[model samples]
Target: MSPAHVLEPTYDTLRRRLLMGAWPAGQRLEAARLAADLGVSITPVRDSLNRLTGERLIVSQPGDGFHVPRLDEAGLRGLLDWHHAIVTMALGRERAGRPDEFQLTGGDLPERSAHLFASLVARARDEELDWAIENAAARLGRFRHHEAAVLAEADKDVGAIERMMDEADSPGLRAAIDYHHDRRRSAVDQLIAASRGGQII
Candidate 1:
């Protein structure tokens, strides 16, 4: 197979695994081992790691190869704040219509919440904003599984956001967004501990 063919799948698989927390934070990603496990050559794994590093899904050091980013409280707060800003900006824009295709009621809480945010962001009709939200989401995805463990009524909170979106209540939606992010912001320590102790989802 061509390098392009090998590279795309390798990149996609690694990206999925990384976002899903397949490896713990701060663990070194060995390209050779990953290549062997994925049944690809080391070159493609290295290339994929480099691409992921650029996307901020993976981190690289001069002599340390690549490793999963260990998010400190400050780092995690920065990401949450950044994502909240993007989503809030999208909400402030006047969209032509809702994303009718996104089913907010049909998945696990995290998946549904993701769709809800995607639908909200899609309304902005700005590619750059979409890209920014996606990048933020990917970086934060691994920590999402910890939310349920730390946050009370997590599902209800997401449900309220969904309902606000469905009802076209912009003010309510914005408030819900603030509450959602602020609640998480306040519980950063619990969230970090939960993520560290919990099994990889």
Candidate 2:
């Protein structure tokens, strides 16, 4: 295979591992070790690491190599803010032809919802914005992997947002956006606390 073709899957696999919280926050990642684990040479692993660094999913420190970023509340807020703006714009544009209520299931609700929002944002016809939304979603790491109650609550919140969009209630949409962020922040806070209470990563 071509170099690009060979490296693309490796990049994707590494991205999935990060998003799934395979590595602990702030865990150092040695390319040589990863290359050995993935049964590949260091070259592809290095290329994949470079791509992840570009996405802000992996941070490279001078003389220290790459590491998964430590979870940060401030960074989370910034990402939520970015998500809010892009989603609001996309919803506004889709208001004229809003579809039926979002049909969300329970298991994997967070990942599914992220995909749904990413799809909605894609309707904005801006590739850069779409990619940004996806990146932000993936960078969420284990924060969204909550209990059943949290997942159910998130499903409900998305339904409310969908209803607001269908009703063309701009104010309601804005409110829903705030509600979503607030709920997500609360969930993350709880998860952080629980993690500190002996739940590793």
Candidate 3:
């Protein structure tokens, strides 16, 4: 088998760890240590780190090495704002021809939330736009994992969205989306505060 094929599993494993907040933000990811921990060679770890850098989960510097991204209030706000704009555009298209009812499957709250957004984005009928939103959503998922309060509150937001979907209330749906973004912004603020206070290690 090709070396890249052999390393695919290791890459996936590391990606999951990064998304699940296994490492604190700003922590340097040493390839040697990660390979030792994962029982793999450094090659796969390096490859994974480079891939994650492209995804914006981690960044590499000439001398600083690879590290999980750290967001200040402004940076966090910018990310959230970007997410908001893309999702709003998607929702607008969804509202244009919204159905009378909607459905949500059972499972993890975050996964369900993702399904809600994906469903709306799918309505846009633009594959490239959907791809861009999904890509950004994946990157933002890491930030969501960094704050427990955000995840807990996301359940309520998801339910609100579900209700809006069932009623096909476009205005209500927009309002719910706004509320969700507000909560996420607050969560980012709290994370910044905690980090400054040395509470987040």
Model 1, residue 62: C-alpha shift (Å):
1.2
Candidate 1 wrongly placed segments (more than 4 Å): 96-102, 198-201
How much lDDT does candidate 2 score?
0.70
- List RMSD in Å for every model shown: 2.7, 3.6, 3.3
Residue pairs in collision within model 2:
none
The best-first sequence of candidates by lDDT reads 1, 3, 2
TM-score per candidate, in order? 0.90, 0.79, 0.82
Candidate whose TM-score is highest: 1
Q: What residue pairs clash in candidate 3, if any at all?
A: none
Which pairs clash in model 1?
A: none
lDDT by residue (113-176, candidate 1, tens digit) is 6677877887778898889888888888878767887788888788888777765536788899
Worst 10 residues of 3 by lDDT: 192-201
* lDDT agreement with native, every candidate: 0.82, 0.70, 0.72
lDDT of 2 by residue, 122-175 (tens): 656678778878887877655565533343456677667655554443677678
Better lDDT candidate (1, 2): 1
Better model by TM-score: candidate 2 vs candidate 3: 3
